[model samples]
Target: MDTLALKILFMVGFIAAWAIRTPYQKRDKQTKRLAARLVLRERVLFVLIYVGMVILPLIYVFSPWLSPADYHSSLWAGYLGAIFFAISLWLLWRSHHDLGRNWSPTLEIREGHTFVSSGIYQKIRHPMYAAFWLWCVAQALLLPNWVAGLAGMISFGIMYVLRISNEEQMMLQHFGEEYKAYMQRTKRLIPYLF
Candidate 1:
């Protein structure tokens, strides 16, 4: 497919993702937080993630500023990206649906947070992150721009690396042995293999 078509597809996926998260985000604001680690570093990383995943990609889609960094990808790759995008959307929905009120944008436990170990959470500790990895792969294939395409992975990778251990530690502190057993049974992002 042509680059314009690919960009349109990416936008559709992006909008769909936003649609999926909007209600959850709205609801999360009403949920009381029992614990939070929204430190300055975390806040900065979150902003970087937004810049990489949302701003840069949107700029690439809407303007020619990133065209100098554009690279041609195979048509098949774009098709593969569409598939990945679809799966990512499904996983995103499932993750949010399964977690429900337990979901939060930041590192915090809600007042009535429960240990979720069902559905997508059954095999992996973080289906949402897995969905994001797929989304990043999809973006790289769909955008065709070096900076915009790869930014999601780069920024999210940094955040994941810096935050995942702390996230798990928080879970450990909250759930204690239950989380440890869950950790023993499930991989962080992948199932069985990782």
Candidate 2:
């Protein structure tokens, strides 16, 4: 398929995946306080970063931001990045699967929610963030142009800061000491060594 068609197909799949995988709902969240709780910057970053991650790789297959040149990768870098990318994506899918009815695109906790400390959660508190960072670093190695790759890296970095801050605050507010204990036990992005 062509670039535009591929982009459309990927985007459709992305949205559909989220729609199907996300088990949370917006029952009475039309309130102003609840609305205000969702940080606009974080929300925008989530959208932009996610779209950029998907679209950037698609561009590699579609558009030519820059032609492939004499870009070389160390064997170690390729092996490590590919391994991390695959593992990270699997962790993400697992985290989302385990989250089930508790998953939200933004940082809103459902009423009477329980903290998740199972599956990928036991290994890392934020597998989703880990996946994102893995994706950025992986793309930097996988893609040819420094410009395209750097865009993903920079955007993910900014988004990571915002996402961690906002998500942590929400976690604290919703999960309280239970989450604090989890935080003490697990690192944020990295697993055992952060």
Candidate 3:
């Protein structure tokens, strides 16, 4: 398929995946918020990531931008991008499934949110973030524009750097020795390789 077709396909899948989870996420959000609220930096980072990963890419793909022909990768690369996207979709769904009510858009913990360390979470403390990273890689490969292609990594990179430690700290505070033990056994985003 052509680049536009591929972009459309990927975006549709991405949006659909989120749409399927929207109801669950909304229900999850209605729960009472506990401690460890999202700081301003985390909020700002999320906004930047949404813009860079979603809005910017949509504009760059549909509108005429500096997406020079030189930046467009080979057809093989697009196929690879599709593969990455598929992996992202699977990981995203599984992350949500494993997280269940434990999932939150922000850093805040839910009432009765158990420390999860099974399924995808068994080896990766943040599979959703891993999914997002895969999405970024897929975006970079699928999109041709330098700005659109790299925006996801840049956007998520900032959040990952600033928020990960804080998140782990919050988890540590809440789960204490259990979380620390989990950390000792599991890597942050990758499995047995971080």
Candidate 4:
């Protein structure tokens, strides 16, 4: 497939992902938070993620600025990317659905938050993160531009490395032994594997 077609395909998937998250994002705003840790460092990381996952990808799709970094990928790779993108969307939706009002954009424990160990969470402690990893994979395969394509992984990887320990610690503090046992049994992302 041509680059233009591939870009268009990516936009469709992106828009669908956005639509899936819209309701959940809005719902999260109304739910009262019991605690939150939106520190400056966390805010900066989020900004980086926004630039990488949203701004850079948009620039690559809509402008010629990233054309110089474009590379050819096999047709099969593009098809595989579409598949990965679809799976990411599914996992994203499922993660939000299973978490319900327990979900928050930042490190937060909502009022009445319960330890969720069902649905996708039954096997993976962070299915949402796994979905995002798949998203980055899809982005890399679909964009065909070195800087734009890899930006999501580079940015999110940094944030994941810096934030996951803190996130798990917060969970341990809140849920105590329950979360610790969950962690012992479940992988962070993959099912029975990491």
Candidate 5:
């Protein structure tokens, strides 16, 4: 019963976010025409990534019961997680600010959408995803609640895994040589040497 309640709470938050921002921000990827070029493995991987994050934590929390005492963390570790998460949040904020009208929940790249190569984009291609992952790690560390932390990290990771690959493929199809050059110039998710 307790586990189910926690799962409900987690889902409520996820649904709330998807509802509040995703619908309004969605844009067309224009590169969907290149769908023929995508590999079957990639498509399968994408689905797995999406569902994995959503369901993985549920397995641990809602399916198998766990408690606070079942998990543990040090204050220092929590603090470190907080710092990393703060950095991640900052990155996420900047990504949103920079994206402006180009933001969307689904894979949508507008007809006039140009690749962003400046600001945080200069260092990392997927600052938003990186931020999400970082925040997940932070949540996991700070909460020290196995279920909550796992859900945060897993869901965020799943989103990133799907979005990054899809976004990259779309960019490659849309921007072509320019995107290639940019990829060479900047890292994928990490800022340096990643």
Candidate 6:
């Protein structure tokens, strides 16, 4: 298959994976108290990520403005991108499964939220973030357009750097020593090394 096909497949698969969790998240949201919400900085990052990963990529795929010049990469790169995308999707699914009702689109403590340290969560505190990184890498590999391909990394990388400490602080405040112990045990986005 060609680069455009690979890009479309990756993006579609990414959307489908996230869409699968929408209902569950909505159901959880009904009961969630929203102890905290994203501040202006985080909200900015959220918009950036959404636009970079979804809007820009779609434009690049379907329109000529974004993808001005066609760059060539080997078929092996496409296969590698597909593999990364697949892994990302799996990580997303598993992270959602582990977090369940505790999951929120933004930074917020859910009502009756429990500190999860099982399954994939046992190894990494933020598997979802890792999945996102994978998605970014996949996008870079699958899409040849510089604007679309690198946007995910640039947008999401900013968010990750700004938000991770705040997220950990929020969790630490909510869970206290329990979360501290969990943090001591597991890495943030990688296992054994961070």
Best by TM-score: 1
How well is each residue in 74-110 modelled by candidate 3, as lDDT tens digits? 8877888888988988998999988888888888888
lDDT (0 to 1) per candidate: 0.94, 0.63, 0.84, 0.92, 0.61, 0.85
- 2 against 6, candidate with superior lDDT: 6
- Winner on TM-score between 2 and 3 is 3
TM-score for candidate 1, please give it: 0.98
- True-structure lDDT of candidate 2: 0.63
Clashing pairs in 4: none
Go through the candidates in order and give the C-alpha RMSD of each one to the true structure.
0.8, 5.3, 1.7, 0.9, 5.7, 1.6
TM-score of every candidate relative to the true structure: 0.98, 0.73, 0.93, 0.97, 0.66, 0.93
Residue ranges of candidate 6 with Cα displaced over 4 Å: none
Q: Looking at model 4, how many pairs of residues clash?
A: 0
Candidate 4, residue 73: CA error in Å? 1.6
Top-lDDT candidate index:
1
- Candidate 6 structure quality by residue, lDDT tens digits, 1-194: 68668867776876777696687777875875758756677678889999988888888877788756557778887888888888998999899988888887778887788889999999999999999999899988888878888889999998899889989999999999999999999999889999
**Clash totals in order:** 0, 0, 0, 0, 2, 0
lDDT of 1 at 107: 91
Q: Global lDDT for candidate 6?
A: 0.85
Q: Model 2 over residues 1-194: C-alpha lDDT tens digits?
A: 23243334334434543554444444324322332355777578867776567666566546765545325445565555555556655766777877765666666665545688998889788877786677667666555455555557887888777667778888888779998898999988677798
**Residue-wise C-alpha lDDT for candidate 5, range 1-194, written one tens digit per residue:** 24344334445444543444453455333223213333564566456545444454444545544454346455576557656755765776688767765665456555446677777888888888787677567556554465656666666565565557777888798889989999998888886768
- The digit string of per-residue lDDT tens for model 4 on 121-185 reads 99999999999999999999999999999999999999999999999999999999999999999
Model 5 spans with C-alpha error above 4 angstroms? 1-69
**Candidate 6 deviation (Cα RMSD):** 1.6
